[model samples]
Target: MANFNDSNVLSSTFYLTGIPGYEAAHCWISIPFCLLYLIGIVGNSTILHIIRTDSSLHEPMYYFLAMLSLTDMGMSLSTLPTVLRIFWFDANEMTFDACVTQMFFIHSLSLMESAVLLAMAFDRYVAICNPLRYATILTSRRIIHIGLVLLCRSTVLLPPLLIHLLWYPFCDSHKLSHSFCLQQDMIRLACADTTFNRMYGLALVIFLWGVDSLGIIMSYIFILRAMLSIASREERLKALNTCASHICAVLILYVPMIGLSMIHRFAKHSPPLVHILMANIYLLVPPVLNPIIYSVKTKQIRRRILQLLAPQRCFSTFK
Candidate 1:
């Protein structure tokens, strides 16, 4: 760690030898990941544009969808370049402030995305269960308000949480097991007793993510009940179908969080390369796959994506 008295500084200059073995294998994996990231960026950007330009899609559903895309971009911005550096250039060292910034953004966006998913679930429930009030409840003003609340909530919560992390003292072992300085990885480096850190983290997880997930499940329960009550079997089936993509998305994020936490606890001493691989996968999997799942599940979005990618007809009846 850096020797500064006041600022808790890890050293600025650091060494990062390339991946231990199978360097070529890492490169092969990274090449495909880079392509996936490119697709994610382009695809999400197109969705944002279509959502903005098409007045029909300006409701709360696509609004939350756009926010989800934005949060994914933020998550990618925080994780991907550092991961690429680790994979391609062997440039893994990060300054103390850089590492803290990375951690804060990654966590902040993650929390915000969770809140956005919550909003989406509420939207779905209302649409399926109470179509009449959906327009009034999910109006433009209400969505804007919800967006602000989500942004402010994550911003306020994450900074104080980060300050606590930053000031917690670290031991001399500056080497983080993961490709990026995740919360637990950085805490492992702490010189002070980190029981407090673990407890606080668990509390946050239970309160924020855990409770929100429960709420999503409840929303789905109510939605299913309402779907069953509908007179038309086709309407009931359609309502059920609309929820499939969100269920997949929720699984992608929360299931990985479980794997990541487990790996941090039981497998920290595992191979350094495996640690790095899981870290990158945890960050990349949800964002890269989310827009794809939603697009495939939602026909309107799929059509828009296809039309945007289609080559324009050159000489079709110019008159």
Candidate 2:
């Protein structure tokens, strides 16, 4: 008899036990998801490496991009593995402890990403609206302090939140309807009353991510209006173009996020299978698209990416 505590035994046990019901044909879905996950890792890693190695990108905007890439990496890691398992292994059976861990990370990283967006918006506002004092206002020390503060604040949410999840009683059908463990899906599995989880989750989303996104939107509106009043066409174009990448990023990040919240809240009656797909989109799409948005819209990143990858191609030196 193999002891469950034995490392190799446990690995073999949970791996093949796959999701409870939908194990068949999960392979088809796993292939595409695996591809997307690979892209997310490579893209985000490139941004992090380039930002760190290239001294030229050591400004406030790229500093925010570094944080964004870090959060994107965190966000993808939190949800993607479970999703891949669900797709390939039929592994819908998450123990209560594992479920809570997943929820904590997914929520924490989601919050961190939102905070990074707000910081990016502030950076853009300073760069476009007040170019002269940009360095003075957003010094390296200041940026690092803000990053630490954001990390600390977002992290503090987890201990209390996970404790809240543990308060719930588990149902017999511990299988999560969603491919991944979501706060909503976990709450739905509660045998005891789950009134608190729903209310608490909604409240946090509203006050935290909701407020941050609202502020970002307002910042851009003011920026655009201010751009209109500028005298020189060159200056105006420069200001707007600088913000172009930031705006695209905000839209791609927030739109699906808000949609996911709405779907969880309002579309409660949808089939679990449908909700599973939605959750995948919510978690996966942003990271997959974010690097593309930055690479395409941000001139500096585009040039750096080209330079960084240029060595891989075979360019001939003519005699």
Off by over 4 Å in 2: 1-23, 312-319
Instruction: Please provide TM-scores, in order, for all candidate models, with all chains considered together.
Output: 0.89, 0.87
lDDT of 1 at 217: 91
Q: Flag clash pairs in model 1.
A: 170-191
Candidate 1, residues 254-307, lDDT tens digits: the string is 888778778877986777777666666677887888999989999878766766
Tens digit per residue, CA lDDT, model 2, 1-319: 1432343222221121233355676787678888998899899998888888889888888989989988988888887777777676655566656766777888888888888989889888887777789889999999999999889878886676568765554533455566556677655655567777677777877888877888898888878878988999998988888887777777777777777767777988876665556667778877888887888888777777887667445233211
Off by over 4 Å in 1: 1-20, 24-26, 266-274, 311-319
Give the clashing pairs for model 2: 18-89, 18-90, 18-91, 19-90, 19-91, 19-92
- TM-score, candidate number 1: 0.89
Q: lDDT of all predictions, in order shown?
A: 0.78, 0.75
Measured by lDDT, the strongest candidate is 1
